[model samples]
Target: MGLECIRGASLAPLNTFGIDECAEQLCLVHSDAELREALALADQRGWPVQLLGGGSNLVLAGPVSGLTVVMRSRGRRVVRRNGDSALIEAEAGENWHRLVVWSLDLGLHGLENLSLIPGTVGAAPVQNIGAYGVELCDLFDSLQALDRRTGALCWLNREDCRFAYRDSLFKQQPGRYVILRVRLRLHTRPVPRLDYAPLAAAWQALGLKQPDSRVISRLVCDIRRSKLPDPARLGNAGSFFKNPLVSAEQAAAMLARWPGMPHYPQVDGSVKLAAGWLIEQAGWKGHSRERVGVHREQALVLVNLGGARGGDIMALARDIQQDIERRFGLQLEMEPQLLGN
Candidate 1:
């Protein structure tokens, strides 16, 4: 069955930011066949196609004069079980938070730390979503995607995905492959990560010597709530910039300037500076001009205080980039994808 394609589709409802935009041709594809058909139609029309998952990470300023295919497909099931771990497959359209809850119910423990993060499971791999000492790649098995150029479904292993900090192969080569479903290998037994600051603090407060994955999940949810604003009330993507990683020498130099600095040592021998702290120290915290502002609770978040345009957010982001560089000599990169280039 192909997509029952429509003309003049409004994208405002599809994206979480709710910026008023329209796709010349928009599709709500429930199946991969429908997705392929929609893409084929977009190809024939010479209009570039954008694959939208939950639209939580997108910023749409004005009318998108092209084809935007929103994945409405959804499902969760165990494809195969391997001893204590099983290969769990989720359709591209499955709500990410729901999937986490479902996994917890099934006694799967790996995805617990990623609870309450927005966007569909299909889009998680693109940015390698991580929180509280866990990343999506830790439990990754493989994923299936439709290659638009070849018009064939292809399977990519973890290595093929080439995931990095807030980056993946799909994001690197955008528009080439549309993710259909993701397969994860999670442990039946708990392998909890509690090394992160907030999670550890939450555990200490709770007075638990050895906590399970569920405890970490609850802690993460509470910490995130206290830090980041709810997107429904205030329009904003989670984090606006990637935590900049600098060399040891650079870190030492920065420490010389500001002795009180928060940093985490990366696996690749680099130091990940706290982007939120940098923004807060730069005096951008709670900074608002009209509708656009940096979140008061967490400076890493940029908010749309009603009627804020995407351009306004972009300007704020640029201002942060400039300020961070001028103050600390470290450049911050955007985590969200900017539309309407």
Candidate 2:
């Protein structure tokens, strides 16, 4: 099928932030061929191409001046099953939460801890999306991507993606490849991960002797629903900032002063400080000037109350960043991808 392009498309409905903006051109591609055709059309027209998945983790600054290709392809099935382990492949545009539920419905485990994460399957690896105690890298088998520059297809393994905490090679080298599909290895035997304090506490609170993936997934969904504001109700891109990593010595020094600061020591000799706690301590929680504000429940979430412009959100984020840096002497990095100028 030929690629269909829409000019002057409103971008507010495309992004989770609901920021008012427009795209010069927008194309929804349901297959790799359509994606390639759209890219080629952009090249022929001397316009840049921007790739968009679910738009859950994006901040549209203003009107985009190029062809924005929104991936809409969808498919998922078990590619291989060997004894207790099965390999499942899903197209880039498949909803992440739906995939998690589908895996559980098929008696496959390993994705329960990552339930309720927003975005498409393709965007998961880009951020190495993680929650509770499990990350996307844990079950990742391989992924098929189309190299935009060379027009070649490449299969990248976990190591090739260079998976890190909420980051990957796909993000390090932006606009290099368009992820087409992802393969994950799941097991029939339940392997529940409740090591995270919140999950463990919730499990203990439930007074259950043992829980399956479905139970754990339900608990996680409940926990997330309680803590996070629904984007449909109040516009938000989940966590707005990445947790700041600091040296052990720095963490110790800070802890000595605060005594109650939440921190996790990594195997790499670094400490991950909670950004939400820092933001809360800096007095930004439930703070707002006009339409942009920090969520009252989750200090990490910056919300668009109503009629908020991208600049207002950015300004509030900058103010929060400056306050946190000045108070804690640590820098917080934004998690969402900011598009346009």
Candidate 1 accuracy as lDDT: 0.85
RMSD of each: 1.5, 1.0
Model 2 agreement with the true structure over 1-341: per-residue lDDT tens digits: 56789999998888888888999999999998898889889989999988898888988888889999998999999998999899999999999999999999999999999999988999999999999979999999999999887999999999999999999998899999999999999988898898898888988888877668999999999999999998899999999999999999999999999999999999999999999999999888999878999999999999999988888989999999999889999889999998876
Which 10-residue span in candidate 2 carries the lowest summed lDDT?
A: 202-211
lDDT of each: 0.85, 0.92
Name the best candidate (by lDDT). Answer: 2
Write down the TM-score for model 1: 0.96
> Whole-model lDDT for model 2 versus the true structure?
0.92
Per-residue lDDT of 13-130 in model 1, one digit per residue for the tens? Answer: 6666666667777788888878877887887889888888888888876666678888888898999887899889999999999999899888888998899999998999989899
Give the RMSD in angstroms, all C-alphas superposed, for model 1: 1.5
After superposition, the stretches of candidate 2 with alpha carbons farther than 4 Å from their true spots are: none
